[model samples]
Target: ARNGFVVNGALLLDHDEDKLANVLPRPNAVTNRPWAVLGVLNGDYPRLHICDRTVTFGRSPDCVVQLDDVHISHKHCTIERDGNNGSALVVNHSSNGTYVNSRRIEGTATLSEGDDVVLLFDRIDGAMHGKALLGQQRVVDGRGYPVLVGYRVISVNLLA
Candidate 1:
């Protein structure tokens, strides 16, 4: 099975593949893991990978970012725990503008359901999903298993 997940419409994958037939998440009657919201940039295989608690974006092999575990390239973005709200992932806009719901989000913003998050990297747009937001993207090399990113909305129950 592939090791990865989706968040805010961004399809996070584990490997670099042009075409993956088993990228989407499979339906589980038991565990009932929350579904991730995903968005894709323009390309045959445009997906991010979540491995070892880090998120690797794009296929260039150099586009990688650390989410909650180890720090990779600080040039991308920062996902930190909200001091005021323990249930939200506070996305800080770096040199590249971090967009939420197609709007450029400055400073720190709380993410809710249905929110679209686009990490500004040229022309690529990364969308967000929750009960409040719902976006979809094709995931590659997912092994038909859900890629679970710990960054989840605290206010909304995505599974419910």
Candidate 2:
């Protein structure tokens, strides 16, 4: 909470680090913690959790986070915590490709606290990254566009 500013959906990195934009959110008490997002594509995880073990995302049922949409490959990618630090890495190899902070990854990408992981990708004339609620479209902005309808989470007080 007393770290960075919570802009769109996640934390904002540019604000003064000495002052907090808001308070931290209390956990929902669910095993599903942070980083298990992409909820809009398949109603899976608007909110995600990054346990010690590696979590997989794809169209297959075996994936920890399975997305049913055809755009997703049978076995797309994996998100594992990068040590005890509050950071992660995404390994992607989907047919349609996975987006990290709105940029397509060649093979892998490092994920920070405020980064976004997008599964359903369309034509990206140009793109911008912003925090989004679950994975819903209108849910969040698309590449080259501003999507403005989501329940952004800054803290318990900022949840819409």
Per-prediction TM-score, please?
0.36, 0.52
RMSD of each: 12.5, 12.4
The residue-level lDDT of candidate 1 at 125 comes to 38
Q: With candidate 2 superimposed using the best TM-score fit, by how many Å does residue 110's alpha carbon deviate from the native?
A: 0.7
* Range of the 10 consecutive residues with the lowest summed lDDT in candidate 1: 140-149
Deviation from native of the Cα of residue 54 in model 2, angstroms:
0.9
* Number of clashes found in candidate 1: 17
Query: In model 2, where do residues sit more than 4 Å from their true spots?
Result: 1-46, 84-86, 122-137, 142-160
Residues 42-136 of candidate 1: C-alpha lDDT, one tens digit per residue: 22223322212223332233334333222212444443323343333535435545555455577767667545455532212343322221134
Q: Judged by lDDT against the true structure, how good is candidate 1?
A: 0.35
> Which tens-of-lDDT digit does each residue in 43-66 have in candidate 2?
222343233336666767666555
